[model samples]
Target: MGGNEQKFIKEAFDTNWVAPMGTNVDLFEMDLKTYLSNNVHVTALSSGTAAIHLGLILLGIKAGDEVICQSLTFTATANPILYLKAIPVFIDSEIETWNLCPIALEEAIIDRIKLGNKPKAIITVHLYGNPYKIEEIRAVADKYQIPILEDAAEALGSSYKGQKCGVFGDLCVLSFNGNKIITTSGGGALVSHSQNIKSRAIFLATQSKDKAIHYEHSEVGYNYRLSNISASIGRGQMEKLDEFVNLRRKMQNFYKQLFENVKGVSVFEVPNEDYFSNHWLSVITINPSETNGIDCDDLRLALESENIESRFLWKPLHMQPLHKDFPYYGGNIAESLFAKGLCLPSGSNTTEEEKARIQNVIKCLFKNKIKKKIKVKSLFPKRQRLFEDNMLVNFFTKNRLETS
Candidate 1:
C-alpha cells in the first residue's frame, strides 16, 4: 500500500461513507482522468472483468454477436464475451508486440463479413504492458467501422506516440487488481470518450436504480460499482502510479542488462521510439536448441528450485480447451510465444537482495548448461577433429547424442 492509502480509508470510515458510492470514488475517477491527461470519463467498477462486461454492454453487444479478441491475453479479456452470450473470434499476436495482429484482424473481419457474421467489436489488449500496433489496429478498426474495446488492464502507464493506452479504444478498461501496476485491492474502471457513455455505465453498474421514490427496475443491471474503501486505495495507488511504472521499467532494463551476453535469450522490448511500455512485467523468450537444451520451462524450474517464483507466459487463448473450439485467425506466432516465453518476477516492491538472488540462480543455471556442453565436447575427440574440418553437422550430431 502507498502512504496515503490508510489515511484515505480512514477518511471514508470516519465519514461513514463505506458504501460503493462516495467522495473517494468520485475523486479516484478524477485522479485517473487527470493522470491520463485525456478528456475521458471514468466509471469505477468491481473488477477489470466487470468493466469489460459493462463496456460490451455499452457497445451494444448481445447474444450471438461476434467480438474479435487478442488471442494471447488473459482469459478475462475474452470471458466477458461469453457473459453476454457473444461469440469470440480470436486473433493471433504479432511477433513485434505480442499483441493482436492487425493484418490478421483485418482478415478475420473480412472473412467474418463473408460469412455474414461481421464482428461487432474488437477487443485488443496491450499484453504485458506492451502497447499493440495501435495506429495499425486503429486503422483496421476504422476501415471496418468497428468499435474497439481497449483492454489496457496491464498497461495503465503505457503509451503509444505520446498518447496513453487507456484512451485509445472507443471504450477502454483498466484493472486495479492486486497484480496490476496499481491496486485498489480489487477494482477497475471503464474509460469513455463521451460523458453520456460514462453516465450510462455508472447507471447500469449500480443495479439500474432509477431516481424514483420507491424501489424500481427497468432493465437488467449489475452490482459492479467500486466500493468507497477500494476507491480510496485506488486514489492512493494513483499517487504512486508513475513511480511504480518507472520501477517496473527499471526491472525490464535490469533484465536486459542481465541477459545482454546470454545466448538464445531475448528480452521483449518496445519496437521503436514511438512505443513506450510500462514494462509491467519483464518477459523473455528462450530457444532451447540455441542454448544447449535450456528451455523456458527449464529456467522456470531452476528458478523454482531457488525458491524464486517465475511463470510461463499466458497460453494463447485460442489453444485453451475452453476457447479452442472458437474461430481463430492467423498462424503460429501466438503459439510459438506461449511455447518459448517466461515471465520473470517484476513486482514494484522487489528488493535488490531479491534481484541478486534471482540473478545468481539464472547465472548458475546457464553456467551449468554451458559446462555440460563443454564436458560432452571433451568426450568426442573425433567430433573435436570434425570441428577443425568445419563439419558442423557432425559436431552437433555427436554433441546431441552425447547430451541425450
Candidate 2:
C-alpha cells in the first residue's frame, strides 16, 4: 500500500460514498488515463478476468466464434474465450520475446479463413511484462483486419517503441491483482480508444441499468464494477506505479548481474532498446547441459530448501489438461520455455537482505554442482585429462581466467 491509500479510503468513508460509484472510482480512472497518456478511456472493474470478459463482449465475440490467444500465458487470457463459448486457437511463443509468434498467428488466421471460420479476434499477452513483437503482430492483425485484445495484465508500465502497452489493442486489459506491479487490492480496467466503447462497457458492467426511473434491464449484464474502497487503493497505487516499475527493473538488473557469469543460466531480457519491459518478474532459462545437468526444477527445489520461494514459468496452455485438445499452432518454443524457465522472487517490496539470501543460495548451488562434476571427472584419468586440456585452452583463448 502507498502512503495515500488510507487517506483516500478515509475520504470515501467520511463522504459516506462506500458504494462502487463514488469519487474514488472516478479519480482512479482519471489517474490511469493520465498515466497512460494515450487518450484511451478506462473503465475500472472488479478483476482483470472481468475486464477480459467484458473486452471480449465489447469485441462482439459470441458462441462459435474463434479467438487466437497466446499459448504461454495465464489461464485468465483464455478462460474468457470459453466464457463467451468461443473456440480458442492457441499460438506458440517466439524465442525472441516469448510472446505470440507472428508467423504462427498468420498461419492460424489463414488456415481458419480457408476453413471458412475467420477468427473474430486475437488475444496477445505481454508475458511477464515484456511487450510482444508489437509492430509485426499489429501488421499481421491489420493485414487480416482483425481486432486485437492486448492482455497488458502484467505490463502496466511497459512500452514498445515508446508507446504505452495498454493502448496497443482495440481493447486492452489491465490487472491490479495482489501480485501485479500495482494492486488495487484486486481489480482491473478495460481500456479503449473510443468513448462509446467505454460507455457501453460501463453500462454492461453495472447490470445494464437503463436510464428509466424504475429498474429495467434489456440484456444480460454483470456485476463487475470496481468498488470505492478498491478504487481508492488503485488511486494510491497509481501514484507509486512508476516507482514500483523502477524497483522491479532494479531487481531485474540485480538478477542479471548475479547470473551474468553463471554459464548455464541466461536472464530473460528485452531483445532491443525499442522494447521496454516493466520486468514484473525477473525470469531465467537454465540449460542443464551447460551446467552439468542442473535444471530449472533442481534450482527451484534448492531455493525451497533454503526457505526462499521460486517458481517455474507458466505451463503453456496448449499442454494443460483442460486446453490440450484445443487447436494449437507453431513449434515447441513454448514447450521448451516451460521446461527450462524459472521466475525468481521479484516483489517491489523485497528487501536487500532477502535478495542477498536468494543470491547466496543460488551461488552455493552452482558452486557445489561444479565441485561434484570436477570430483567425478578426477575418477577417470583419460577423460579428466581431455576435459582439463579443453578448459585450459578455452580459458586462455577467451582470457576469462585472467579477467577474474
Pairs that collide in candidate 1 are none
Please provide, for model 2 over 1-404, each residue's C-alpha lDDT reduced to its tens digit, 9 standing for 90 to 100.
76889999899999999887899999999999998887999999999999999999999999999999999999999999999989999999999999999999999999999999999999999999999999999999999999999999999999999988899999999999999999988999999998999999999999999989999999999999999999998888888999999999999999999988889899999999999999999999988789877777557656776678787688788877788678999998887887778899999999999998998878987875552221111111221222223222221222211100
lDDT agreement with native, every candidate: 0.89, 0.88
- In model 1, state the lDDT of residue 292: 82
lDDT for position 226 in model 1? 98
Each model's TM-score? 0.92, 0.91
TM-score between model 1 and native: 0.92
Residue-level lDDT of model 1, residues 215-263, one tens digit each, is: 8999999999999999999988888999999999999999999999898
Model 2 lDDT vs. the true structure?
A: 0.88
